[model samples]
Target: MSQHPLARLKRYDIESITRYYRFRPWLVFARAVLIVWKFAGFLLGLRADRGHTNPIRRRQRAVQLRHILTDLGPTYIKVGQALSTRPDLVHKDFLEELTRLQDQLPPFPNDIAFAIIEQELERSVSEVYQTISADPVAAASLGQVYKATLHTGEEVAVKVQRPNLLPTLTLDLHLMRWAASWLGPHLPLNLGHDLLLIVDEFGTKLFEEIDYLNEGRNAERFAAYFKGDVSVKVPSIYWRHSSRHVLTLEWINGIKLTDVERVQAAGLDISELVRIGVSSGLRQLLEFGFFHADPHPGNLFATLDGKMAYIDFGMMDQLEQHDKEILIDAVVYAVNKDYDHLTQAFVELGFLAAGTDIQPIVPAIESVLGNVMGESVADFNIKTVTDKFSELMFEYPFRVPGRFALIIRSVVTQEGVALSLDPNFRILEVAYPYVARRLLSDESPELRRRLLEVLFKDGRFQWQRLENLIQIAQIDAGFDLMPTAQLGLQYLLSEEGQFLRRKLLLALTEDDRLHTDEVRRIWNLVKGEIKPDRLWGAALGALATVWPSATALVTAFTPSEQL
Candidate 1:
C-alpha cells in the first residue's frame, strides 16, 4: 500500500501545515473570487434576458457551481451537501447538481489513508488487523472506509479521516463566517435568519462530522434508540480500534436501498423497507428526538431479512421535547387543514419570527398546504410540498430554522430513497398512520391535549375526524386497537376528561335536540371496528361506572335517533 503511485504527496498534519496556512488563505480567497465571478456572470446573463431565466442556462450555471464547490474541496463540498437539502435556499436546478456532493468525491490514496489509520490507532495496520482491503470500499467528503478483519477474527469496516483537516476546517470556517457577515445583507436571498447564523450552523455540524469519536458515540446512541427492534439495524462500534480520526464498526452486509434491482433480487420487500424507514424516522424525531440527519442512499441499506440498516452517524441532530410536541401539533393542524393553528405552529417553530404579523401568512399557508391532505396517497409526497413551500418561503417571511435543516434533509432523502424503490410510495401513507397511532395510543399529557384538539373543535365532537383517524391508524401494523381503546377509556375516566365530558354532554343537547343519532353512529363505528367480545364487555363495564343506566344507554338509540 505504501508503494502505491498515488501516495506521492508528503504526509500532512496540523504542525506540518503551518507554512501552508499562510498562503492557504490567499488560495482560498482566489478560488472564492472565481466562484463569485462565475455566479455574477450567470446573474448578468439572466438580467440580460430580462429575468426570464432559461432552463438550459440555469442548468449550465448549476453545473459550473457544483464543479467550483468540488474544486474548492471538503469544506465547500460539505457546504454544497447542506445546500442540496435546502430547497428554500437553492434553486432546484442548483440543488440537483449539488446533490452529487453527498458522495462521488475522488478518493485519497490508500497508502496515505492507511498511514492515517496507523497513526490514529497507534499501531501498524498489520498488528491490529488480520487482513485489510488494499483500497477503500467507500470514500466520503471527510473520510474513506476500508474493509478489514481483526486478529480476533471479527470483520469490521475501518473509517479513516483525511489528514490535516483541523487547520483547514478551522481556517475555512472562520473565512466563511467572515464572508457571510460581510456579504449577507447585499445578497438577494430570502432568509428568515441572518446568513451568518446559517454559516455557523453548517460549520458546527461539519466540525462534528469530522470527529470520528463523536460519530461512533452517535452510532451507539442511535442503536440504543432502536435496541431490540428487529426491523432496523445499526452497526456496532469497535471501540477498541476506534479513535477521533478512525472508526471500526461491525461490517454490515446489506443491499443498498437505492439498488432497486439488487434489493428486489434479494427477495426483500422494498415497500416494507420503506415503511420501516419512515416509521423508524418518525420515532427518532417525535419520540426519541435524536435522528440520523444524513439519510442519503449511501447511508441506508436493506438487509436480506428486510431490515433497514442505517450507517454513517457522522451527521445527526436532536429536537427538544417542546419542539417535538410542536411538530406533532403542526402535523395535526395541517391534517385538519386548520391553517390558523398551523401558522402559529410555524411561529412557534421559528419559521416565522415573533410579531411577524401571521394574519396574512395564514391564508398564504392555507393556499399552499390546504390541498396536501386531500391528495391521494399515491400523489402526496414531501417533494411536492417542499417545492411549493420553497415558493411560499420566497413570497412570505418564512425562514428555515437552522435546526430543521437536517430534519428536512433526513425526511426528503428518505422519501427520495423510497421513491427510487417504488414510484408510488408516499411518505404520508406511512407517516400519517404512525402519527395517528401515536395520537390514539400515546398517554403523554402533551399528545393527549393534541388528540383532544384534533377530536374536538367549536365545542363539538368531530365524529368524522375521529373515524378518519381510526381508519388511518388501522393502517399501521404496530397500531393495536386494544391499547388505543384502553387509552381513550383511561383519559375519559381521568380528571383531565372533565373538559371532554362537559363538551360531550353539551354536544348531546346543544340545540335543545337529542344528538343520539351521532352518539349511535360512534357506538356503531366502535362495534363494527372492534369485534372482540372481551373488548365490548370491558368497554361496557367501564362505561357502566360513569353511566349507571345501561337500559337508557341502549334506549338512547331508538329508530328515530339511531345511526
Candidate 2:
C-alpha cells in the first residue's frame, strides 16, 4: 500500500522531526498549569467552597471563579468555557462564570502584527490601505481587529490572526488531550471521548478562524443567503487584498445588540430588532440550511437605519437536506404536540439510529416536550425549552451532531442577545407562524401524507386546522389550509386505498372466499385508528358488510373445529 501524504513526505526527510519535538517542553509546562487549575477546581467543588449550610460562601465562590478564569488567559478560557457547557462535567454556577471570558487581553506589538499582515496578503501596507489604525480596535483569543480604510476609500475592518498562534494552539491541544487521556479512566463519565470531541471541535474552529480567506468566503456565502433582504447586511469582502492570515471587509457601524440602554437612547425599536434576529435565525435553520453559526451580541449589530447586520462568519455551519427535513417535521410535531411522530422524527434524524424502536423513548420525549410546549404560545420560552431537555439528555443514547451543536449554540446566543434588547421577546412566539407556514407549504408526498394525519382523526375531519389557521394568521400571505385538506382527500382517493376496497369486494362476491386472516388484519387497524364514517373508515365498512356471508362460506369449505 502507498504511504499517506504526511508519511510519504517524511520518508524523504521533507519534514523535520525537530519541530515536532518542540511539543515536549510546552506539553510539560501546560500539564503543570493544568494540574494547578484542576487542584483549584477540586477545592472549589468541596463543601467548604459551597459553604455547607452557608449561603454567603456559596455566593462568594462564584465571584472567586470569575476572577480565576479572567486570570487564566486564552487556553483556559476556551477549554474551560467549552467544558462548562457539559452538564455532565461542570457545575451550573461554574459554567456561568467560565462563559464570561469574552473580552480579550492587550494587543501584541504593532510591528509584528503589521509584518504578519504583509506576509499573508503579499503586499506593502501602502498598496492596500489608504490608512490603517495604529492600534487594534478589538482583540480576541484567536485574532484581533483593526479599523482601516481600503485604497478605494471604502472603510473596512482588518482582522489579523495572532502571531505564532497555530503552533501554540497545537501545543496547547496536545497537552489538553494528553491530560484527558490520563484522566479519562478515573472519571465516571466518558471523559476521553467527550473531551477529545470538544477539543477537536475547538481546534477546527480555531483553524477556520485563522484562515482569513475561508472567513472571506463565508462572508460571501452569508451575503448570498440574505442578499435580497434590505434589513440583512453582510460586510463585503475585498478578495484582491485578503488572505489566510489577514481578512479585509466593509465595516459596520451600529449599536451592539447587548447595549440596551444605548439602543433605547438611539430610539430604535428593540422589539422589532428581536423579530428580525429571530426571523433571520429561522431562515438559516429551516430554509437555507447553511447558517452563520455564531450570532453572539458582539457579532450582531443593529444599524442606525434598523438593518440587522451579521459579522464574524468564520464560524459557520451547513445542515444537510435530510437533517433539515427531519428537523422541520420535528418542529411540526412539537407544534401539534404529537410526541409519537416527534419521537419518530427524533429517531430518523440521527438522534437515534435508523429503525431504532421509539416505544421506549416516546413517554420520556413527551415529558420533555410537555414542559416546553405546555405553556401557551405567547408565553413560550425557547431557552427554557432547551434547558428542560438538557436535564433529560443524559438518559438517552444521544450523540450531538456537530451541526446541531452549532445550531443550538447560535440559537441560544442570538436569543440571549435578543432578550438583552427586549425583556418581553420570545423567539418561539415569533418563530411559530414562520415555521407553521413552511410546514403547511411543504409539497413533499411524505410530508403531505403526514399532514393528512395532522388534519384528521381516524376517519373524521379535525377542524383544529382552523387553530393552525389562527397560529399562521400572522405569516405574510397566510397559508392555504385548504391544500392540507385537499391532500388528506387525495390520500383516501389514491389508487392504494381504492385497490384495498376493490380487492376485498372481489374476494368476497366473486369467489365466495375471503382471506379470513387478511380481513381481520385490515379491520383491526380500521377499528383502532380509522374513524368508521370517515373516508377510509366508510370504505372499510363496505368491505366488512360482506364478511358474514364470506365467513360462512369459508367455514363451509373447511372442516370440524374451523366451523
Candidate 3:
C-alpha cells in the first residue's frame, strides 16, 4: 500500500502552515481565484436583490450561500459551521441557512478507510476485533465512523480519518489566510476583529479535531467532570485502539435528543432530557469552564436509562478561571439590570476594548437585555436575546471574541436542541434555576460579590430577589436549602458581610420600627422546601456564631410596625 499522506505529519498549526505551503503559491492562487469568483458572483446577485425585503429572495440568497460553502469542501464547510453560530458576523437569514450546513459528506471507500485504520493501529483488522461493520456508520467532513465489537466483547465505535485530509485542509487554510490578507480591508464586514485572527482560530480548532488523541483526552476530562452525575453519560475512550488518525470508544446506544418521537417511544421523558441538557451545559460553562463547543442534535443523545450522552469531544473549548467568574458576574449584572456593570463585564470579556467608550454601549445593552427582565422566566427565550444582540452588534463596535464565539455557539446550539423537542420550552426556566443554585451554593468570593449585587441595590436589601432565588433554586434536585442557608449565614457573619449587615439594619428600620413583612415572606417560601429540623438547626448554628447580635437580629424581624 502507498504510504499514508498524513503519516509524516504529526501535528498541525496555523503558524507553521506558511512554511509548508510557501512553494504551493500557484495551487493557493488557483483556489483563491475560485473562491473569490464564487463569492463575488453571490455578492453581485445580492446587490440586485437589495431592492426589497422579499422573504423568498432572502431565503434564496441564504440557500445559495450554503451551497457555495458546501461546494467549497471541508475547510469552507467548517468555516460555515463557525459562522452559523456568529450572529454578529452574518446576516440572520444567511446564518440560518449556514446552520443547515450539516458537515456530512459522502463516505470514502471502505477499503481505503479500513486500510488507513489498520495502518494507524498497526494490526490486522480481523485480529483487533471480534466483529466490525462492513460499511461506514457515519461520514463527516473529516472522518467516518464504523461500529465494531472488540475481542473483549465490548461494543465500540471506530472512527477513521479521510485520506489526505491534512494536506487538503492545510492548503485551504493557507489560501484562505492569504485571501483574507488581500481582501479583508476592502470587505464591508464590521465585526470589529481582524479577519485573519478569525481564520487562525478556526484553523487551530480544525487541526485539534483531526487529532484523535486530543479528542480522547477531551472525552476523559469531560467524563471526570461529571463522574458522579447519573443523569449525564460520557463514552469511555479506548486509548490503546485510538491514534492520530483513528479513534475507538465505547459505543453509546440511544436516540438523538432531537428525536422526540423515538425518545418518548423509548420511555424517556423529553422534558427531563431538556432539563439535563440545560443544567449540564451550565456546569460546563459556569463550573468546569470546559464545554463541548459543538453540541448539535447529532452529537447529543438520550440513553435508555434517561441520561444524556455526549459524544464527539473533538471540538471543545476551555475558559480561564477569571473568564468563568466574569461570565457569572455578567449574568448577575444582567439580572440586576445594572447596565454600567454589564458594560464593564463586556469589556472584561473582550467584547469591547478596555478603553472604549461605554456610554453608547450601556443603553444598547439595556435595550436588548432589559426588555427580557420584564418577561416571566417561563416566557424568556435565549434565541430572542441573541437575535436582538445580533442587531446590537451592528449598531456599535461590539465584536464576538474568538473564544466567545464557541461559548455563544454552545449555548445557542443547546437552546436550539431543546426547542426542537418542545416548542413551549423556555431555556431561562431551566437555566435560571441552575444560576440560582450556583449563586446559593458556591462560596467563591466572586460569586459572593455577585450574589450580593443581586440581593442588594442602592444601600437597601432586595428581599424579593433573595426569595425568588430560593424558590427557583429549589427546582434543581442538587440544591439543598439547609446548606445554602448555612452559607448565607456564614457570609453574613464574616467581615465581608459587614456591609450587608449595615444594609440589613437600615432596611429593617423605618421610623424606628421593625419591618417584618419581607422576612415573613421569605420564611413562607422556604417553609415547604426545607425540613423544619434542618432549617432550625442551621438557624441555631448561625445564631450561635453571632450571639452578640442575636437579640438585635431577632428584634429586627419582630412585628413592630403596622404589619
What is the C-alpha lDDT profile of model 1 across 1-563, one tens digit per residue?
A: 23322122232222333345455678667656765775676667556756656788778777877776776678888888888777667877777787766555678988888888887788998998999998888887788889999999989999988776665565566667668889999988876678877876776677678778899999999999899788999999999899988999999999988899999888888778989998999999999999999888988999888899999999999899999999988877877778999999989998888888999888887877766656544456687788778778767777778889889888888888889998988887898888988999897888988888898888677878887888788888897777578667756876768888788788778789987887777676566557566575556555655565863675466343232
User: Where in model 1 is the C-alpha error above 4 Å?
Assistant: 1-50, 375-378, 528-533, 536-563
The lDDT values for all models are 0.80, 0.67, 0.85
Best by TM-score: 3
Q: lDDT winner among the candidates? A: 3
Task: Please give the clash total of every predicted structure, in order.
Answer: 0, 3, 0
> Native-vs-model 3 lDDT?
0.85
lDDT of 2 by residue, 186-251 (tens): 766623246555656776665665577888898898889898878788899988878777888899
Model 2 TM-score on a 0 to 1 scale: 0.75
lDDT of 2: 0.67
Q: Candidate 1 — what's its lDDT?
A: 0.80
TM-score of 3: 0.92
lDDT of 3 by residue, 194-237 (tens): 88887887888888898899999999999999998999999999
